[model samples]
Target: MTLILWTALGYLLGSIPFGVAITRVLGLGDLRQIGSGNIGATNVLRTGNKPAAFATLLLDSGKGAIAVLLARHFGGETAAMLAGGAAFLGHCFPVWLGFRGGKGVATFLGTLIALHWPLGLIACGVWLLSAVISRISSLSALLAAALSPVFAWAIGRADLVLVSLFMAVLIFARHRANIARLLDGSEPRIGRGKP
Candidate 1:
């Protein structure tokens, strides 16, 4: 019952849709009508409002981290893991948005950071390096998710491997369309409007 409650709390936090709120509050229009129609930082960047996009990213990631930290504080590592995973699910399939939401990259990284900072930092490094080289947001996210488990294992955090794998799978599942575009070399770059 406690676990269920923590999970619920995590989901609710993750489902806040910071991108939509920030964009709407700033009079940037509806986020859903923008590029890719995603409620993640990358899509928020399409609004041409760097501050709003940055804010959305921080809030989205913060929700996941906060969920994990809160659960850990109240219920130990098990609850923290469950809450973190739930947060990622909420970000990917937010109930408020008819189960359609972001791809879970930011939430994943944030959750990882909360669970283990070193692992999280390594994953972030992977993402940054990939983004710099590829200039593709989806690809960078994919690479980071894909490599998280390996990094966790390398750093002796065997406990994080399974959760990292689970999040990676979900991230891949959510980015199916982006994967298709990437394969065909049609995936859009970071800042442009279209492919």
Candidate 2:
């Protein structure tokens, strides 16, 4: 019963779709009409509204962090892990979005931060380094997601490894199209220098 409640809470919170909501509130048309038609921070960036994009990024990450923290406070470590995983799943397949949602990279990082701050920082570093080196958003996300589980395990956070691994797999799966573009040297970079 507790697990179910935590999962439901996590999913509901994760389904907020801040990107779409923020864009609309700011007078931007349907976010789905934007680049890649994705409801993630990266897509929000294409709207030429940096403020909206930053807000989306923070809120998207906050949902996952809030779920883990709430579960940990109300339940226990195990509950926190369940909630974190649920949050990631919700981001990937939000019911509010017809089970179509953004990749779980931001939420995944957020969960990691809640579960283990050190690992989260390391993952962010990996993301930053990858982005600086490659300038490709998808590639940076992929590298960060790929490294998260390993960092968790190395830090002796065995309890977090499974959830992180699941999140990583989902992130990779969600980036399938981006992966294809990357392989063919056609993935879009982090910015257009204008929008």
Candidate 3:
């Protein structure tokens, strides 16, 4: 029952589309029609609204952080990790947004940070490094998520490894398009204002 509750809470929290909300509120029209039409920060940036993009990123990350923190308070470490992972999945597959959602990058960062501070730091470093080197959001996210589990393993975070694994796999699945673009040398750059 507790697990179910945490998962549901996380999902609902994740479903709160910051990009959609902010865009509509700011009279930017539906964010879905702009850029890559994604509900993530990167796409929101394509609208030439830095504040909106930051708000989306911060809110998305905040939801994951809050979910995991709540689970920790209500249950334990394991439950916290589970809730965090659920939030990531929800962000990647929001029901309110036609079951299609963001690429789960920012939210995953939040989850990892909440689960383990040092691990989160490592994940962030890796993510930034990957993005800088590859210049592709999809590739950076894929590498970061993939490395998250390994970071957990290195830090002796046994409980978080499972969630990291799922997150890594799920992100890869969600970024199939990006992966294809990556392979074909047509992947878009991060600050290029989306596809």
Candidate 4:
């Protein structure tokens, strides 16, 4: 029951839709009507509002981190992992948005960082390097997420491997369209706006 409550809390936090709120508050119009129509920082950037995009990124990441931290404080590592995974689910399938939401990249990294900072940093580095090489956001995110479980194992965090693998699977599932585009060479590069 306590774990259930923590998971609920995590989901609620992750479903806040910071991108929509920030864009609407700044009079930038509805986030859903712009770019890829994704409620993530990458889509937020399509509005040409760097500050709003940055804010959305920070808040989106913070929600995942906070969920993990809070659960860990109250219920130990298992709860923390469950809560973090719940948060990622919420981000990807937010109930408030008719179950449609972001791809979970930022939230994934945030949850990873909260669970284990070194692993998170390494994942982030992988993402950065991939992005620089491919200039493709989805590909970079996929690469980072796919490698996280391996990184966790290599770093001696066996307990975290399953959670990392779970998140990676979900991330890949959510980015199905992007994957299709990637395969066909039609995916847009970073800062090139929506595909």
lDDT per model vs. reference: 0.93, 0.88, 0.86, 0.93
> Which structure among the candidates has the greatest lDDT?
4
1 or 3, greater by TM-score: 1
Q: What tens digits encode model 1's per-residue C-alpha lDDT throughout 124-178?
A: 9999999999999999999999999999899998999999999999999999999
Report the Cα lDDT for residue 106, model 2.
86
Q: Considering summed lDDT, which 10 consecutive residues are worst modelled in model 3?
A: 186-195
In terms of lDDT, the poorest run of 10 residues in model 4 is: 186-195
Candidate 1 vs candidate 2: the lDDT winner is 1
| lDDT tens readout by residue for model 4, 1-195 | 999999999998888899999999999999999989999998998899999988998999889999999999999888999899999889998999999899999999999999999999999999999999999989999999999999999999999999999999999998999999999999999888865
Model 3 C-alpha lDDT per residue in residues 1-195, reported as the tens digit of each score? 988888888888877788889999999889888878888888888888889989989998888899999999998877887789889988988988888888888998998888888988898898899888878778888888888888888888877788889989998998888898888888889779544
Q: Is candidate 2 or candidate 4 better by lDDT?
A: 4
- Candidate 2 or 3, higher TM-score? 2
TM-score of each: 0.98, 0.97, 0.95, 0.97
TM-score of 1: 0.98
Q: Would you give me the overall lDDT of model 4?
A: 0.93
The order by descending TM-score is 1, 4, 2, 3
Flag regions of model 3 displaced more than 4 Å: none
Q: Which stretches of candidate 2 lie over 4 Å from their true place?
A: 193-195
